[model samples]
Structures are given as C-alpha cells and as structure tokens.
Target: MDALIEKLKGQIIEQLNLVEVKPADIKPDAPLFGEGLGLDSIDALELIVLLEKHYGIKIQNPADGKKIFESVRTMAEFIKSNGKD
Candidate 1:
C-alpha cells in the first residue's frame, strides 16, 4: 500500500504536470483537491485517465471520483480493491 501511494504521487505529478510537487511533498492523507494540492476540474480528468491508462481501473461513476480521489491512500486503496495493483 505504501509503495502504491508513493508510486501514485510520482504518477500524479507527471500526469498533471505538477513540476513543483515532489513525491515526498504529497502526504498520503492530504486532500488532492481544494486546499491540499489545489487541483481543479481538469486535474481530476487527468487523474481518471491516469487510473485507466496505468492501472486499468475505470471509475464507473463520476460521483465516485470525489471519494476515490480524496487522497493518495484512498486512490491506492481503490486500485488495490479493484485488483489493479
């Protein structure tokens, strides 16, 4: 799980072109949007694509994204539960 979270930080930074954020800078429990990473709607779309392209996990419902993308830990858990990790 820790490994997955670490990998996710790197993937997110690259996918979203967040050159300022390093893997160590993203806390596992920190929010990915709003005040945390300050990611907007477009970043969310990129995250969806990231999951599909890298983990082969497609979010069935758009509403689920809010929960799944709560934090690196949650995203990693979602991928793991979906058998993508």
Candidate 2:
C-alpha cells in the first residue's frame, strides 16, 4: 500500500504536469480538490485518464469519482480494490 501510494504521487505529478509539486508535497490523506491540492474539474478528468492509462482501471460510474479521488490514499485504495497494485 505504501509503494502504491508513492507511485501514485509520482504518477499524478507527471500526468498532470505539476512541475511545482513533488511526491512529498502530496499528503496521502489530504483532499485533492478545493482547499487541499486545489484541483478542479479539469484535473479530475486527467486523473481518470491517469487511472486508465497507468492502472488499466476504468471508472464505471462518474459519481464514484468524488469518493475515489477524494485523496491520494483513496485513489490508491480504489486502484488496489478495482485494479492492479
């Protein structure tokens, strides 16, 4: 789980082109939107693509995205449950 979290941080930074952010900057349990990472809807779309492209995981429901993308930890958890490690 720790390895997955670490890999997720790197993938998110690279996929989103977040050059100013590093893996350490992303707290696993911190919210990824609004007050946390300050990500918006566009970033959400990129995240979906990131999941599919990297993890071969497709989000079956759009509503679940709110929960799945709640934080880095949540994303990792979702991937672990629905896709590869």
Candidate 3:
C-alpha cells in the first residue's frame, strides 16, 4: 500500500502537470482538492484520466470520485480494491 501511494504521488504530479510539486511533497492523507493540493474541477478530470490510462480502472460513477480521491491513500485503496494494482 505504501508503495502504491508513493507511485500515486509521482503519477499525480505528472498527470496534473504539477511542476512545482514533488512526489515527496504530497502527503498520503492530504486532500487532493480544495485546500490541500488546490486542484480544481479540471484537475479532477485529469485524475480520472490518470486512473484509466495508468491503472486501467474506469470510474463508472463521477460521484464516487469525491470519495476515492479524498487522498492518495484512498485512491490507492480504491485501485487495489478494484484489482488494478
């Protein structure tokens, strides 16, 4: 799980084009949106693309993204639960 989270931090930075953010800078439990990463709606769309492109996991319900993307940990958990990792 820790490895997945670390991999996710790099993937998130790359996917979101967060040039100023490093993988080490992202906390596992940090929120991906709002006050945490300051990501907006468009970034959320990018994340969905990231999951599909990298993990082969398609998010069927947009509403579930809010919970799944709560943090890197949550995202990793979702991916693992879906047997994507």
Clashing pairs in 1: none
**lDDT, residue 13, candidate 2:** 95
Give the TM-scores of the predictions, in the order they appear.
0.95, 0.93, 0.96
**32: Cα error in model 2, Å:** 0.6
For model 3 the local lDDT of residue 63 reads 85
- lDDT per residue for candidate 2 within 39-74, as digits (tens), equals 788899899999999999987787789999999999
lDDT per residue as tens, model 3, 1-85 = 9999999999999999899998888989988887857799999988999999999998888888999999999999999999999
Stretches off by above 4 angstroms in model 2 are: none
The C-alpha stretches of model 1 lying farther than 4 A from their native spots are: none
Using lDDT as the measure, what is the rank order of every candidate, best first?
Answer: 3, 1, 2
lDDT of 3: 0.92
> How many angstroms is residue 52 displaced in model 1 relative to the true structure, after the best TM-score fit?
0.1
